[model samples]
Target: MNTFQLSCFLAVAEYLNFAQAAKQLHVTHPAVSQQIQSLEKELNVKLFQRTTRSVKLTDEGKVFLWDAKQIVAISDRAKKRFGGVAGGNIETLSIGCYNFPCMFLLADTLETLRTIRPELHPRLQEIPFQHIYRMLEEGDLDAVVGFKESANVKINALYKEVAKVPMVCICSGSHSLAGQKELRLCDIKEERFVLFVPPKGMLSIAQTQGQLMGERPPSEFYFCESAEAITVLVKAGYGISVLPDFLVPDTPLISRIPLKDVDQVSFGIYYKSLQGNPALKAFIQCAKENLTALDI
Candidate 1:
């Protein structure tokens, strides 16, 4: 019945968890639950089947999901159009990327963007890495924030390097390989490895193996969903992992040693083209100027 209700419905539909939806929307869990309840009541239909352990969409919910997305998209587009006219020519740049700690780095850049180009408003979405680049190509997203080595990037898209993030080997501070100035790929091969879920993660590992000339792969491997998750496992002594240096926490509990032979990933923005897009150009400049302050 309302944009707020529709937004809640879309978030819950995407994540299937009220808590996660609330987190994404920056609202309380009960607030999201209330919105869904109000929405379902207004529609005279049950949208989701709830359980203590899991949340699943009902049959009606499944049918309404696509419609809800379209409704929200249209509403957003209209707001941008009319809002721009009312504000005497404003621009909206829709950006998609994986979730934060990366966004943490972008916060300063976005603030700088505001100062430099107040007319340009950025709309950010935490899309899955698998679909992000494709959305950019499809024009659903104006830009993508990710690594250059990401398997999802295409040749046609232009890239602006924000930071060169080195690949580092991470382990518990008490681990045998800790206290080293740096490490070779072979040094960690015998240890159990923790990686992000593939195929992007696998491509990174393969690239590292090839470039670092690591002959033997780790005997055991663990796959995690996020770098934070991987770091948690590594700190618990579950396994060692290779990750962008910026992703590794500064805590003393973990040792982050640079990989001796691996190349740093070019982390930055990707867009189709900058032609006639002053907003995109200004954003790139702000990102380059501010993101370099990252202690790579």
Candidate 2:
């Protein structure tokens, strides 16, 4: 019903743990719980599933986070319609991004902006790919950079082709699969794979490879939502994973080989369909300057 109530609800829904949510909100655990209870009462539905050791969002809570954020964003933007700027200043650009290595684009953009206007400070949040769009629409972010997908979601790039990082199948350097210079999907048909999948969604990239193989090769698959987890699995020799080649060069223990027939992964800058924001426009321009180096 109110901003306070919605804020508490989303915080809890994000951390999925009362103490953690309270820490993030800088409030007491009881305070967080009280607000969530108030929201549940207002909505007449349970928003979460709770137990002694764990907390999880109910089906309703998952959907509510998006709509509630958008409402809050619109309200906040309405209050500061003129951006609190007198004439023109770089001000701020809030950005969210997937945990992909696509930050090179953002870095170039911000660096260029710094040279022209050093006062610019772009707030940044590292988020999952799926959350980027919702966060932008909610006013939490001005733009996002990650893999692009369509689902009534509009996306665009400052450059023609997608900005991409060369990703390769990484295994322990001395592992059996490391001997090959490059490999096809069939190379690891029977080996274990450390795959990254969304906590509540599909592994779109891995699925794309599966479809391209014509037949989904039987792989001993292990899935985790965290990219770090997947990397750890690869390090422990549990399985090889597809990761940005940038991350492997410094590691002496990991070896990355190309997926024989698969192409480089596509990544780009995405944002909601909205009029241009100056900070974002500047960043896009900087990103375009480095476009050729991105291997797009």
Best by TM-score: 1
Task: Encode model 2's per-residue lDDT on 247-291: one tens digit a residue.
Answer: 343476777787666656555566554365766676666766765
Where does model 1 exceed 4 Å of error? Answer: 1-89, 150-155, 202-205, 209-219
Candidate 1 C-alpha lDDT tens digits along 111-140: 989987888879989888678778888888
Candidate lDDT scores, in order, read: 0.82, 0.69
Q: Candidate 1: global Cα-lDDT?
A: 0.82
**Alpha-carbon deviation at 214 in model 1, angstroms:** 7.4
What are the RMSD figures for all models against the true structure?
A: 16.1, 17.1
Clashing pairs in 2: 183-260
lDDT of 2 at 66: 92
lDDT of 2: 0.69
